[model samples]
Target: MKEKTPISLHEIEGVVVGHRDGHGFIVRDDGQPDLYLPPNEMRAVLHKDRVRARIVRHDRRGRPEARVTEILVRSETPIIGRLLYENGVWLVAPEDKRYGQDVLIPKGATGTAQPGQVVVVELTEPPALFGQPVGRIKEVLGDIDDPGMEIEIAVRKYGVPHQFSEGALAEARALPDKVRAVDRRGRVDLTDVPLVTIDGEDARDFDDAVYCEPARVGRGKGWRLLVAIADVSHYVRNGAPLDIDAYDRATSVYFPRRVIPMLPEKLSNGLCSLNPGVDRLCMVCDMLIDAKGEIHAYQFYPAVMHSHQRFTYTEVAAILQNTRGPEAQRHAALVPHLLNLHDVFRALLAAREARGAVDLETVETQIVCDEAGRILRIEPRTRNDAHRMIEEAMLAANVCAAEFIASHRHPCLYRVHERPSADKVELLREFLKALGVPLTVPDAPGPRDFQAISKATADRPDAPQIHQMLLRSMQQAMYSPHNVGHFGLAYEAYTHFTSPIRRYPDLLVHRVIKALLKDGRYHLPVLPVPGEALAKLAKRLQERGTSEAMTRSRGRPSQEVLGWEAAGLHCSANERRADEASRDVEAWLKCKYMREHLGEEFTGTVTAVTSFGLFVTLDSLYVEGLVHITELGGEYFRHDERRQELRGERTGVRYTLGSKVAVQVSRVDLDGRRIDFRLVRDDAAGEARPSGAGTGEPSARRGMAASSLRSAKRAGPKANSGKSGTGKATPARATRGAGKAAGAQSPGSGRGRRPRG
Candidate 1:
């Protein structure tokens, strides 16, 4: 008899991610592949709960399957869902299907929430092997279709801190409405600088103001530029109630008609805001630039500045276009200075080009909502010279800030954007080669390589598609104490220093710069945040330590370095969180808008192609929906990864990234934030029908749709009819933009810019 060896089990700790289906997975904290948990193993755990699991066996597909060993932490996040009663029992079905389990609500635990109304639930008992989780209604939010309900649900669903703590609110209330004398002590007076804020029309929190004038740089023709950012650190002290609340939120969340501010309105919109004709404390980045647009020298200092005016992008652009026009006449007193700023901007732009920074253009849309909180329309936002000017100024200031900190050997967070991974670069090269584009992508490419490709393909019909692929090939920028340089911006060092009023990292930057100015080191206070809040951050820091830049550094990371790393991770994660919440609200709004036009046909461009379907963005409405593979035609379609397209095997019809098509909206799943579209075939009948239908096609081809429907039926009614082109459960928000052009917007700037890379 042969003795069999016992299977060695691997134990892992991770957060539970539940699917709408009975199955779930453990998203391992060690950055390894997720371990699948079948319906049986998921019985005793809920979504987002921390758990330690052991790999019991590998599935037939060679995937590791795990069983729950212990529940380390039950997620305290409140669940947002609708309260329902049926079969002599009350329960709440979570709005976010990821929760997977219906929470049972006992009698009297439903509170004031009515049946079918959306409510917030707090778990009272964890799920057992054979029982559903039990919870009590914690807050009654209102009807599912009420105005602003999406925002309400999103804030809670994503755990975004929407309400200010009582102590923070009290502290804000006690602060003076105007800058006081003591607050301005030892600060350089910049009230005479004629600094003016340039922002969007609806901007409230004016975080940055700029002033520029012709000056002598070592007896050469040059310009002196001043970028004064709101000093949020002065008002929100470290570890205070306001600071704690601000840290919790990390960044302000912007929606269509609302903003969930990081700090209270008193700080975001009043005292710290550089409102026109008001004295405000600021951190100034004063730079001397010569004819070439390169910085000759720079200095940072605390300042008391008064914004001479607040100009919108449109107005500034109009004035710059024609100094004698009506728009220019209104701001005649500031015309000459504006021209100097324009000259300096041109010089800086030249420098940017010389540095070979990646500047990919993308379309950004703004949602127009009416009084009822319903979307009226979606309009493409325009960017002009004024926007670019402000962007260049902010960029220059940020670079200087990074250099200043590095010079002082300060342990502060740097905005890091590393080069693309080898795999992504290879994929991009193959894609470009498949398209027959006359360009070469090297294994180790720099910002110049990408910029060159963008320049070469600018006139192509598929330029937007190619640009999107380039953007996707790059890695997302993040905050880190270990500076690896910003690949997208082509900067050796960069840090966010312009919008402290909205971004917590910028506030930290202000503190560090202040400490450096005083010839002292800034010590991070023991944050009031929980250890769990930083668990994911710790993992990310550990991962970052393996980067090439980190390996090149000398010594073991200090406590301060680790603390800054944690802060960086927290800020980066919250930034993404805010983005997700905003996108959710937008998607919900778009779904509602599309519902009114069901069965209507519209022409659109195929933005993405996957094995399952094509994602189409309507030209007129700017709304995106999925055209499932089953609805493509009666023929089998095979996805071509290299070409980024789907091709019919029998019929020669092909749909690529830039393909144009007309589709009729078939289904709208508001709950799922999904919209399904059926292709409108071009036939003599001139009627909307699934492609290749009604023809003498083979039975196998004809039965494709039926077979897909049958499969969907077997999967259950709640199964998502179609997924995003990326194979994600939900359709991704239409590509907004990326890189410096798409970076997060400063308070007074144009469309928000994403991190350059």
Candidate 2:
């Protein structure tokens, strides 16, 4: 009897990630390698749709190719796009190119939106094999050129909760405008203590205040530091309307000129904010640090504080620089207190260096905007001693919070950052070796090892690039119940104990601390709304392949542990969501800013090297754009993955990270958020000229150069077409152009400092 043919199909479940070029990828739920879905398989699905797919076969390079077998869930997110009327048919083209297909709008469904106006559309029907998705206009967001339109689009696109629920708003409105006598009954009265809040000039919400004094610790001189954080838990009770809203938002999203707060303005800006000369309830971390900067003793307590003064970072820096200066004379009474704080900061910094913490400095730019929300210019934000002083104080309190919860055997979310994976370490080693840098990585690396490499390469011309690579190799920090420790800060335990007014995780920490103080357990109650939804999304984003390993390490977790894990996951996902939304708004603004300088020439340094092109950051504008491979002369170029460079085969000219090159702006696509550049060749020296030599005028040959570049790109490369030097298929075109060009941090409310972890 002839045996049945062996079945070779392997089914996998994953989320669809669409590309601008119509192809897509299935990011497996199991955390395995992603499966490539050709353009045909993506026709029936949109971005972020979950589905079950059968792997038909593997390519020659061992990459899996899949076909969709079943649709699990269609995304419920509303699409944000520009309404277009073409050939007598109404349609909406998604601002996010990953959607791949336009949504068809029926004649009556197009609300009050004009043809070219941006609008939000709710899908009425999902896409089929031969049909497009259909949607109805739900909201009109005004014209494309309207001021603050980018932020409006970003909030909706990332599913950011911008508006507070009615119930939440009612609860906030019912709260007292100031801390009352009844509220101070159970709290220690620290109103007599001369504490102050130092933050950025633009800071609106003051979450923390600090004070320091000299003390005696075991026959040695020490400092007593008090960090007071806004007591948000005192007002936002568990399972309350305010609590639900805060949990849904998870964190506040900061944009260029706006902020979508987690709590209502009544609480975030007025009631909970520790504004100067106001009676505010707070949770204080009172600590005794020895001369060596080690925390000798600590205690947590609720207190009523009256901020003596409000100081900006710039003002504080000036005062500290010259004690007898006019700025210090204005606050002569608080000058000594500031000096004490500075003393403690120095000791803490010494301890940090001794412990071998990873401190990679990066250039963070702040956008200067006009009254109409147009970009005036971009400037690098300068950090001063005042910023570091407050940061160190907050870090110490966070560490104490983590230790306090762990000591009580209570479950809480710990900010954990694991070591780099093996593959990432190997890749980093290969890159360093190719650059002839002397470094040795251990089998199990730690934060100190990475810091050592940074110090050794501090004098190198490519130090910035090397430091960035090190930062990228590290894993992202996330909240988790399991204490894996933070690799970057070299801390055995850490948690967010500051900024409860803005971050939900810090509020949870406060509740846990309060419960421990009362000798009672803080049981996470069942949330009234979106509990299951939050848990599900958190599991999808956080569990990946770690769930099995967690089960293996420890038997099945109890229900309490499970609840904490879900909360951690939800908070982590929302943090990432907030970051992405902020970045998206910034990118849109930068694209708009670059459109006015389309034909100007500028010298820039290569910030990133990829298979398709080099990402160059302009010296004066501080803006980044792409220099496509085809624009790098006529010789065939091959991408070296290990060295992160592109080398020409005929002339052996290489363009690697940190290389300086002159390029003229060739094209700007505001819709695509892309800026393309053409290399400006120095025919006399056959090398790139130094920056500042550009005439800064619109180039006359800009159109001719753009046309030539496009023609060459269409003809494709002569050799190594569709492949890298390692014989791997070139990555998706969308991966190379999007998100890399316009990367900048938003001007956040004094919370822009890198997290301690």
Candidate 3:
């Protein structure tokens, strides 16, 4: 074997990013600014190819320019695109469009792929200084308009591991179709308990079931709650082929019309699923709740249970609404049990409120897709009492699991949500003060402080923006071996223990709980040495989630601590990957849906104000598109970053968040996942009003002024005394670039090379 050369200090390695016009840039791995690669330098590299380069000199724009010295690795991910033969040349244009450069498929390399048909291509040779990258057709994925084609493309584009390994598939196939007698050994017999699964109407895999009944506790009214989660760990042991595959996915990816499950169908939808009338093995969190909705005591155990019924959210909601109605009469035996669950839910809700949990109501939209995978409508998903009941039950169970492990002094991955950082809290306070609704977030503010702020702005016309700002001010929750407690839920400790069939961390939690119940500690698998790939994943996990301090805590044994840290990092990174993949698929679908409504007019709310333009979300379609600042008016508009609004300098006309506007669909770029809208004026002459041209009211301006002052105070050299002027607060729009230069081009239109040093 040839000896590989060691990387030198000046020789940096990074991924190649290409542009439409054949120019490229090296996104350095060391976090330095990207190095410009002109057309000549890019001839040797394709988009996403890893290469080692050296900064030879500076470009005319004073940006660092690099020359490729070696090609380190070619991306193994297959590219999905359409095959086209033009002028005796065969080429494949990538569906993602990020590839920038097209792949050349020779006549003999075309395989069975037809012209204009979608196909997966494997790179046969990296691009050379004078040639394009060469590829061979690996698989035909059908036509572009075929059902679920978008999903197939998304999975490939995001590099989501959707296919199960052959070993995992074989293992799943060999497993019993149903729970066997041997599987019931050493498990408690709760098959007679009327536990039932409550899920969404379209739900297929039932991961959890719940049952509640009245109980006597020390001369007081109490309730016995049984939360039985599908015991996926029993079938898929640690380090097994199934476990490895599940860990690679970490969490299931849910798209509008399809789901990429963490486990094979045989496990997630069959044996491990809590289907009605079937005896399934489960890990039960049995709790005793007082009348006050406080969990007095809890225990975990392995059990076998039969689900009495599988009810949907709508069915449960209707039954709860009217106990004597036809829906309730149909299942009279389960009615009383459901009623008890509802009663316990109300108590739990009261307890939650008393605990000062951060409860903010926000609209969640669901895309309704037809059999052909075309979006029919976008509707707001409403939550009812049934949803709350199930959520509360899950929360109680999760809390108990976290407590069980903590009390036993065993390290485990916790579902952690920390409080907002100091800087974000300061910005929120300043914004609130400008709106005449000042918040007193103490040095050590809790969820209650956030709840108070939410309540004060609940009735405001700009409540959506305010709530959005509040949400942004908080940190995203992630898995961590260190328990900082969940700030949003007002829990001292919390972990995900339900739905192990879909979430890898939950399965790990179940195994830990089971081990603790058997009077032992569950040790995590020994992690392999942190190699280049694993280290990169760990870095991404740290950046996307909790800080490094939480990843590896203090006062823990070396090997045990390292094992938990690795597990936490892996789970967190994969979770983020799943979310990004799902969002990418949804964005693609939404873009496709909006392409049909081009040139149509619709009324929308200004959900975001950027220096470049306004982002309006339509009322009827729930689609959000940008109305670039140039389309705002003929006059000059200035972006006020502090106030989060765009002010037309000439007329003083302001366009802040929550402002309703009429818009016409101007353009849609499916490749870029971008939608553009043009403003539709309702006044005479159909022209937009200038800032101060026709309107004499300066109320909005005054509010903006107060907001500006608050901003200045916070940015001042001296310490802020926490005082803010009273005025109607401006809505905090989505944080996007706010200037004409920033708004001049859509991301899709921008080239790979940016003016940076």
Candidate 4:
């Protein structure tokens, strides 16, 4: 052991950060940065392995310093995530932290795991003599069950996919794809129907088509709207490859960069995609509605349509708004019809409003990435009128489809959103009462009830908070063969009859629509065999969920975390990964871009608060960076999770998520995906008033101060002391870049302050 080492401090265990030349782990000693764990001695240690280590040699650079004397814990594990048969051997690769090397299962222990299948494994023996670690297969998941399955596998292998299957793929490749002449013999051949598909500029697969014309109801005073959807089942018959894949997927997985479609490309992109000018099959919902948006007459049929024009929402909106320039003229023939469509949409919107449909208008951030999958920027994409207009049309069409299917006495999967859980409702009720917010909830407050409550608290200062709470109190919608009216849409009946390319349920609905039109009975999907590898996947997912649910009750720790149900936790974790990956790619690009401005000032919002630091969200560019709370001022700042605030001891000023402040770029960590910032007064933030500061609603920045609190360090620099080497404070001018009044200094202001390297 090295002499002069701080004696009697807790014998700190070492954590392996990296490995070198089969020698051992490169461990780090926390308190002292200039020390590391040498190899050969660290053979038992692994990455993230905590060990009892002591200082042997302190390098001048302060790292490469320690020798691990004992392995406090074994880092190897039995349960592994990615075990499969490879090169005549069963190899188990774990998908967890620590990233340990793969374990090879003996040929004698092959069990049920197949080549190219995702299976869990258990290590029986550790690696020896240059041979891999050994294990046996525990379970296997079927070939990534479509889109949802891929995500599930990806997340799980990451220790996170939150989805379930209904034994749908068990009945695979049993049916045909193309509609036979015998199949078409009984169905209506509405090949001449003037149905057109309206989608986005980038849409590839068209699911539903519409043919709306003027009609009179209630004594000829209302207009009749016809909503026709692509009859997908006509082409993709029961038990076909397309059907099997679709059913397995359950839903489409839409990644930011690409989509793993539920159906095969041959089917999703070719046979059933409903491309314009092609003679495509579809299930039609013909509804005769009045001016009051009530359906007076409706009919369901199996029909064929040659989509007249594949119109973009932008083009439709342009025609409807009468900005018929060259772009609108490109699709000139549909102008009058599109206008009539807008009229229908207007009426539907009114009906929706009258029904008290919630206008949940949260903007979504679209990530722009470069060729190498690095994020270019994060910007809010506009959901223009065209988007809403198409949405209204789809909603009406889905209602008509659901009503037609139900009226015909056929059973099908319904998109159902149940009322909030009893516990949630009770908690919300108590919370509302405490906040003095009056709400008249029925025995069960549905979407309309939530809407009423939101409207009541609209103008209140706590509107966002209340709205967020109420939103959280609602139950998420899910799919079931049971027909329960949708609560959120305020509809008596609803099913997804659109977007079959993205959702398997919608394709199933289309199948049922065709089945009923031809007078056929509904067939149940087949499930996996008992004790089969596939069954283990479903069972394993359930078990994984149970295990995770137990951990959620332990409460949260760090940032990028919220709640912990199996599904919720999985989604949250995946969301964090996605966000981090996106942020990493963006930060790399942004840092490369921001290198142009070394001493620039930018305005930002306080996005998060922690005991150690605050995260600031830049307003102009939307880039986020950390502002260590320790750098708040000369005095101590205390954090209060209850009030979501950080209070200054003497100034009494508080900072929270929405608190506005100008910050100067202090440092950047590209590989670590971090951008550091230091808070600046408006005067130092430059004349460019962050566009809108006071416009943002005030956050609850109410908290207590850390008055008279002392640092854990004997002589540490005060917060934001702008110091350099070994706790010497960086100069005020260099630290506060854009120029603000010099901050106050204390006894610990200039000496022994640590810069987070």
Top TM-score prediction, candidate number: 2
Q: List the residue pairs that clash in candidate 2.
A: none
- Candidate 1: regions farther than 4 A off: 1-7, 59-61, 528-533, 537-556, 683-757
lDDT of candidate 4 at residue 604, scale 0 to 100: 62
TM-score of each: 0.90, 0.90, 0.84, 0.60
Task: List model 3 lDDT by residue over 693-721, tens digit each.
Answer: 21212222211112333333322121111
lDDT tens string, model 4, 202-246? 567777677777887758666656566656565555665555555
Task: For candidate 1, report its TM-score.
Answer: 0.90
C-alpha RMSD values across all candidates: 7.2, 5.6, 10.1, 15.3
Candidate 2 lDDT over residue span 1-757, tens digit each: 3232222576878788887767788888766677788888889999989899988876655667889999988988789999999999999999988899999999899988999999999999999889999999999999999999999999999899999999999999899888887998989999999999998888889999999999998899999999999999999999999999999899888888898999999988999999999999999999999888889999999999999999998999999999999999999999999999999999888888889889998888778899899999877889899989999999999999999999997889999999999978987888889888999877688999998999999998778888988998899999988888999999999999898988989999999999999999898867533333443544444654446424435655456766777788788888999888877777778878877766666667777777676777876677777766556665566778778877767666677777777677766667666667767755576443323221122223322323444434433322111112233223322223332113221211112334432
**568-639 per-residue lDDT for model 1 (tens digits):** 878888999998788888888888887787666666677777766777777678787777665665555667
lDDT at position 318, candidate 2 = 98
**What TM-score number comes out for model 2?**
0.90
Pairs clashing within candidate 1: 199-748, 739-756, 740-756, 742-753, 742-754, 743-753, 743-754, 744-753, 744-754, 745-753
lDDT of prediction 1: 0.81
Any runs in candidate 2 off by more than 4 Å, and if so which?
Answer: 1-7, 528-554, 683-757
lDDT of each: 0.81, 0.80, 0.76, 0.55
